[model samples]
Each structure stands twice: as C-alpha cells, then as structure tokens.
Target: MAWRRDNSAFDFHFFRFFNSASPNNTMSSGLGKNAAGVLNMTIQEVYSSSENWILYFQSGVYFIRNYDYGGDLQIGVDSKTATQPRLLKRNGTLGQQWTLTKAEDGKSWLLTNGLLGKDLFLGLDGAKPVMTADKTKGTVWGIEMNESAGLPAAGNDLITSVQNLESPPVSSSSSSSSPTASQSATPANSQTAPPTTTNTGLLTSPTSSSANGITSSVEQPSQSLSAGGFEFDWGCCGVGFAGSGAGGKD
Candidate 1:
C-alpha cells in the first residue's frame, strides 16, 4: 500500500501540528449556502490553514473527515424515509465508508457509498450534499494533494521518492527496452547467400561434309556461359569460320 512512511508517533505529531495550525470556521466569509459554497469555504479553509474535510486515499480505501464538524460526516440513512443520506458521527459503520470511482475525464471522480447503493452529490434543493442512485456532474469531484498532506507534488514523484527505501529497486533489465541476446548476436548480412552457378551443358554435334555425306566434328568457339546466374555471350571466335558449329563455343 502507498502511504506516509513516517512512524506512527511522528504521524501523530505531524497531524497535531497541522490541525492546530489550521484556522477556525470564523475565518471563512462571503460564501453561499450550498455545496458550491461549502467547496469554496473548504478551499478558503485550506488557504487559511483551517481544518476542513480532509480526504485521504490509502491502499484504495477512501476516507473524508472534517474534525471541525464534530467528527466524520457519515452517510446516515433514516429508517422511515426513503434512503436519503444525512451527516452523522464516524463509528466505523459501512454507511460512512466510500470509494472513489474516477470519471471518463481524469480530472473528476464519483464518490460511491460503500454500504448504500448511492453516490454522493450536491442536491439542488438543499445546502447539504446527499446520496442518490443516479450519477451526474454534481457527483464528480476533484482532489488536489498538498504538502501539508504529507505527499509530494506529483504522484510519480511520490512513487519515485519511496521506490528505493520502501520497496525493492527496479532492476535495469525490467526498466529498459534493450535488444535481446539473439538479436544482438545475429549479423545483418547473414540472410544473403552467395550467388549461384549454373551450367547449360556443353553443346556438341556432327556436321555432314558436302563430299559424299561424310561427317565432320563441329569445332565451336566458347559461346554463352552462365556465371553468378547471368549469361555472358562471346561473339563468333574465328572471323572467317563458316562451319555448322563455327559460332562461339560454350
């Protein structure tokens, strides 16, 4: 779980220091009487160091509390009425628990009640926030982390800071996209084989002599030769030759 690394004792001291430094409710002013107003008031409270609803995300579990409001504002359900959420004390009840579901846009999130099948949203008719079955823009909220919350500026920065001390160091093999052993060992030109050699077979024939059908062996000069898959032609070897096989020999 990603969390504050400070010892429990130190955490307690830190919380006390910040809580004491926070401003009181009397400091907030010029706010309306609705959820928007509450958000503005909370933001003002944060600037003034006043204790507001402190939202925490730990090990995927979410908790929102405003100690100044006498305890955590739990989602309490009235038995008689339809399941309408109201603020109550924190007693580790399921109804008080919530999970933050991020929206299609990364900036906003929907806070869903753990026990009741309802989402926290700003009711149009009332100044207080409530829970409903339907999700809407009113239900979406954005949370910003501050240094007072014991978190670094960036989420990745937080992960990097604790990476070495809290968790095992990430191996270079796992972090890098280096070439594999086989890929590095193979030569690029290995796919090309040497040129091939082919022979058309020597051509030989007997020519008939003009005198009484006597036959004579044809003596031809070197003609076409196949080397490296290419044919090379040597013109007639003898200039005055006029025999049947007098052309270039193979």
Candidate 2:
C-alpha cells in the first residue's frame, strides 16, 4: 500500500522515520544545530526537538516537514550530475512531493518520488550525511510516533475563562428596603448607576464603591485572546542534519 495525503487529523501527529540500516538513527533537519540556507538531510539519534517531523498531507502527496523548523524535504540537483535530498521552503513543486509504500519487511516503508522517476527511492548513501535516490541504493525506514510532539489544543485558555465567568461569586451583602439619610438627600435622577458588564460576561475594568462607610471592589480575571489554530513559524536558519553535506538552492 502507498501513503498519500488525506488531510486528516493524523497529519498533525509528529513522527520519526528510523533508517532500517541503523535503527538508532533517524532523519534530522539540523535546525537545533544552527544550520542555515538549503540543508541536506542527515541522520541522528531521535531528538524530539529536531528529529520529529510532520508528514504534511496535501493534494495527493506528502510534504515532509521538520516539526520545529517547518522546512519541507525536497530533492535538488547538484550541477546536473547528482540528485540529493534537501530541506527547503515549501513551494508546492513536484520535487517536494513524495509517496510511501510499505516494504516487504512489513515494518518499514519505501519512499519514492514519482516525478524524479518511479525507480528512484530515497535513501542515505553509505555513511555519508547526504540523501540519494540511486535505483540500487534506497533506504527502508521504520515509522514511529513521537507522542511528546503533540501541542496544546487551540483556544483552551478562552474556554476556561468563559467557564469561570459563567458563575460569578454571589454578593454576600444584603439589601435594605429603607433608604439611608444620604440616599434621601440625593435626587433619584442624579444618583449614579452601577458599572455595566459586557456581553462576554467580563467587566471592562476593576470598580470600587463605598456605601454607609463600607467599601468593596469587583475582582476581574486577566484577559486572553482566542486562537483559531496553531501556526508554525520558520526562521532564516534551516535545520540541517548531524553531518555536513552538499548545499543547494534555498
């Protein structure tokens, strides 16, 4: 079976693809190591901050992206002589699209780029840090989930604030039917009104009042903005793998 983008919730899950040749080493973009510009894919021991990636599903293919740096894994040519895997910005190009087929081992996946050629498979070249797609030298990768990569749900702070606002503390002071000396002296139309609450059930600001020598203030909760969804921001520095490899266009 082949893997294609489905736009499902599973697409957000972070994963690490371990090279079958070296189970302890996985693909890394080297973002945590301060690599910049176009980066060649390198292998490293699983590091949630750098090794975890999101197979962003879109259209009919997957755009493999670094979980932290957000750069898409792509194929680039070097002087028209060598083709290598690179980490670059997502441009929706054919070079950035990939498909995954389950290997015969039943536990590993064979990654291929149809645009490059159906025969070319993504794999490391011996012990080098570069990724190659030679027909005879492709890698089978073991996919595993990184549970710690999950992020907090969007708008959670807003929900909790609304819940607390729904039940305001009941006023403990009792009301008296008879009017006081000061109340009788003041004209009914000239008396001040109580503070107004907004439609969101939050006070505009803190307020205090004094009546018959007694003073009290309404407690207010800190305001928070609601977030519609999570957004990943990529910096100028690209996350490269552990080993140094050939450079390509950014």
Highest-lDDT candidate: 2
lDDT of 2 at 106: 44
Worst 10 residues of 2 by lDDT: 157-166
**Which residue pairs in candidate 2 collide?**
29-239, 29-240, 30-239, 30-240, 31-239
Tens-digit per-residue lDDT, 1-250, candidate 1: 1223211101111011111112221111122212311322233333332222334322223334432232224334435323445444333344544555444554334555545543343221222245655454245443322223221111111111111111123456676321111111111121111112211221112112222211122222122212111111222111111111111111
Scored by TM-score, the top model is: 2
The reply for model 1, stretches above 4 Å from the true place, is 1-51, 56-60, 70-86, 118-126, 146-250
TM-score of each: 0.35, 0.50
Please identify model 2 stretches exceeding 4 Å from their true place: 1-5, 8-10, 31-33, 37-47, 71-82, 127-138, 152-250
C-alpha displacement of 53 in model 1, angstroms? 2.4
